[model samples]
Target: MRDLVRKYKDFLAVKGVTFDVPEGEIFGFLGPNGAGKSTTIQILATLLKPTEGTAVVNGFDIRNEPDKVRQSIGLVFQDPSLDERLTARENLYFHAMLYNVETTIMKKRMAEVLEMVELADRQKDQVKTFSGGMRRRLEIARGLVHYPKVLFLDEPTVGLDPQTRKRIWEYIHYLRDKEGLTIFLTTHYMDEAENCQRIAVIDHGEIVALDTPENLKSVIGGDVIKISTDNNEEVLPVIKNRLQVKAEKQGDYIAIQVEKGEIFIPRLAVELKGRINSMVIKKPSLDDVFLHLTGREIREEGVNAVDRMRVYSKRKH
Candidate 1:
């Protein structure tokens, strides 16, 4: 966790970030690539001491009591950490040994975790032979081999297919409900964050908002109004003062966060009748919240959408 913190902060990436993950809650860390989500997680997981602020996990300061914080949490990193050469069972066994689980409990617990993740059949197979999903499940099992009280999943389901991603979502709930483990997850996936008890949204290294999914959605006015238009250089400020909420210009669409789009739609329809070719109204999404806060798309500048989608994929989102 601490190592990850430093990796992201060496260039002074984070700024005035502060939040807490309550016990027994599935807390989400939401942000784009350079939003400082990873940097904060590294500190919380005891991987890196913050260059400034400090995080305390399980009552121990992340900077001064790193070992205590480490003891209380399990971390599954953004990058693949599993050994391709090792079989799933071997991987769990190795981690179990490192954690000093009692001999009698190690075998039983290993079996339990493997079965829980539905990787029991593949326990004997080398990770390299497994598909992307299999390796991820095995990595999750390994993270749980020691049964730490809190588990940090960084972009938990990155490369898996839809079905696999859904399976992993169920597993995350299982960790919280059955195993009594508090799951700390950082993801771009709106669906995944919906499952969290609480969520903190960060942008540009600052936490923009924190609340349950419903509460967060409730903050936005009403239905979302999306317009097809351009010349953001011309329309943005006008819309901002008119709407009193965020107006994001993407390609030809200007998405506005409003309380009552039913009324705003018609009024806005007339206001920009010729400016925009068309408009639509729908429910708000995490994308809207993110846009409201940062005024930028999830895969903002420099990060290619397909490449970001393909590499981080379901893992973050």
Candidate 2:
């Protein structure tokens, strides 16, 4: 989207964000609650209009050619959109009809997608009888009924068990690799974002950082050394002056970033001696990158409807 902006009267939900996704690449939008990730996705999916700017999805203008844009893209929403009473095959068949797929090819397409999601055998069972993961897989199968070029997965794995989430990603990867489908997704899960080819970190209606996970973490320097000490007041300045490093005091601990944490630990051990209470060193993470850029943690918990309305209300006036 170029110069995209969404305003609810006065509240700015998305601020002139611009980015591109190449065909067949898995692109991710990563952020926390109230961060406008969903708002941006809505614009791209033709579900909402942008106050300013334009986007071209599969060569169709999102504003003037919304129908064409809708035709070329498939959307899997955060909430369950499946018909609980319908069998999986019936649901897929209904979607195929709604999308105007040729009747001759509908059965073939249903079989292909069902087999892709590995739900062909259970296609006769009601959706309510399937597990959460199975339901999600069927939803994805439904999205593929018309063979969309680009798929938008909004928080696709929310509320599922870890194993289920992993299985969902395996299917996602299979789609991109085997079917050559371009995938764009929004997620709050850090580990989930790592699976994407690249990610844009959004917060408070803006893109603060965008890059691959490795490159984003590299921007924070090297390994992270977190120290818990009883004498932070005494040790903070000593470490800074002697080591020429900056240390951030975070509540009960001092967080220091260095090129080589393991190598530096011996020096710290000898210099501080008995003064050190506890310390641990490890590699930087996407969470560290978010913290480095935003100075706050991207909330892992999903926001409720009331909280969403409250954010909207705050933005309006």
Candidate 3:
């Protein structure tokens, strides 16, 4: 493993996780609520040291050389950390100052960043008045003020509409393509995870699977068999006890991974006696992989899935 992050759970905790991050590619970490996404990011970012296994960022051991590690990475937290009262330009300028960029260089970089995020016209507008998308973009601009080689983005497009989310994906590619920035991205959105060059599926503090999105979905072993049951939870165990492949309760429906979804659907219809409310069957998804790995839907309403798993080696938690 090139870079490793590890955790140990004792009487006080509920989970332990470990994983290796490959360099110079967009590595997407996927999991449900409380899947230790934050814990992993903290160790990799060198913000929280691990309990057991060590992490190396940019060839520097995090435990031995945290300062060097800190200098190599930039992090965009899930929450907006920008100063609400300050104008966007001012916020960025302050970050440039902290990085010790010369005054002329800071001005040039500030203008470039404001233009990059499409906020050149409103550079003087208070951050409090900017829209959610704009604030998110500005936060990203602030993180890049020092030109870090690796960017750790924790749900960068949280609470954004579809159009804005897609736009951020374009910016993510821009970092990889134009700037050659290595990215460690953790996202609950399946579409966002698919944009990565590779993905590592984490659940219960360990990687369940890792591969390219297309490859992972394609080789998931079976077509999906879906049955819209009255109570998805009640019937899942009954069906799972007899089925030879992976099965899960998805919302108001029961989904089975089998060789032929159509065939399984008919068999299920015969066995369940009553018709379902609705039924749909298709190939697996990263969402499906996440659910199957963690036993819960990725889009379950009203829960921050990422925060649930990230519960180790934390301070001020």
Candidate 4:
């Protein structure tokens, strides 16, 4: 997407965001709730039109060739969209019909996808009888029924358990490595973002940072030293003045960012020996990278007014 913009009356939900995803790579949009990740995906999937700018998906321009764009992309919605009354196979068949998969190979394609997600055994069962994870897997299978070039997974494992989430990611990787499908996903889970070859961190409708996870974390430039003490208020300034390093109170610990935390730790231990309660050293993580860029931690939030407006507008449109 180049210079993509989306407006909801006075609120700008997506601000001139621009990026490209290499074919067959797992590309992630990482951010907290209401960060325009979904909006940008919707525009690319041809579910919503951008107010300005355009993107080409699978060799088709999103604006001028929406039908072709839709044909080339598969979508797994953030929310469940399966027909509970339909059987697993029925769901896949319905989706295949929508995408106009040739009748001669529809059943073969359905079986292939069902097996890919390990849901072949339960294909005849009603969707209502399936577990959350099972249903999610079925949804994924349904999305692939027509063999699209790109798959858009909007928070594919949002509410699944850790084990289930892991299994889902396994399937995602298999899709990329085995099927050679370009995977575009939006997520708030830092670990999930790590799975992507590249990530675009968005907040409040703008792309704040985009890079490989390793590269993004390198921006922190060193290890993180977290110190816990009884008198945080007194020790905070002392450490800042003594070491002349960046130190701030993060909850119960004073987080210090510096190069070579191991070298810094012993000197710190000696200087604050009597007062220090505990100390922990760790490498920088995606969470730290996000905090460093946004000046805040990612937190769950309800749908913002702009998101609500976008939804209502989508329905109206």
lDDT of each: 0.78, 0.87, 0.77, 0.89
TM-score of candidate 3 versus the correct structure, residues matched by position: 0.85
Q: Show where candidate 3 strays beyond 4 Å.
A: 1-20, 231-246, 272-274, 300-317
Instruction: Identify the leading candidate in terms of lDDT.
Output: 4
Cα TM-score per model: 0.84, 0.87, 0.85, 0.89
Query: Candidate 2, after superposition: displacement of residue 186 in Å?
Result: 0.8
- Over 4 Å off, model 4: 231-238, 248-252, 270-278, 300-317
Candidate 3 residue-wise lDDT, 1-317, digit = tens: 23344545452221444455666788898765555677788877888767666767778888899888888888898778899999999999888887787888788878887888889999999999999999999988887878888999998988998988888888888888888888998887886898999998765556778889998887666787677877777777778776556777776677788887777876777766684777777888887777665566677434443453343225324
Question: Cα lDDT of model 2 overall?
Answer: 0.87
Tens digit of per-residue lDDT, candidate 4, span 97-135: 988889989989988999888899998899999999999
Instruction: Report the candidate with higher TM-score, 2 versus 3.
Output: 2
TM-score of 1: 0.84
Model 2: per-residue lDDT, tens digit, 1-317?
89899998988989899988889999999988767988998999999999999999999999999999999988998889999999999999889989999998999999998998889999999999999989998998899899899999999998899988888899889989988989999998887899999999998788998999989988998888989877898888888889877676655777787898878888888888878888888788887788788665555353574475465546764
Error of 1 at 297 (Å): 2.5
The candidate that wins on TM-score is: 4
CA shift at 120, candidate 2, in angstroms? 1.7
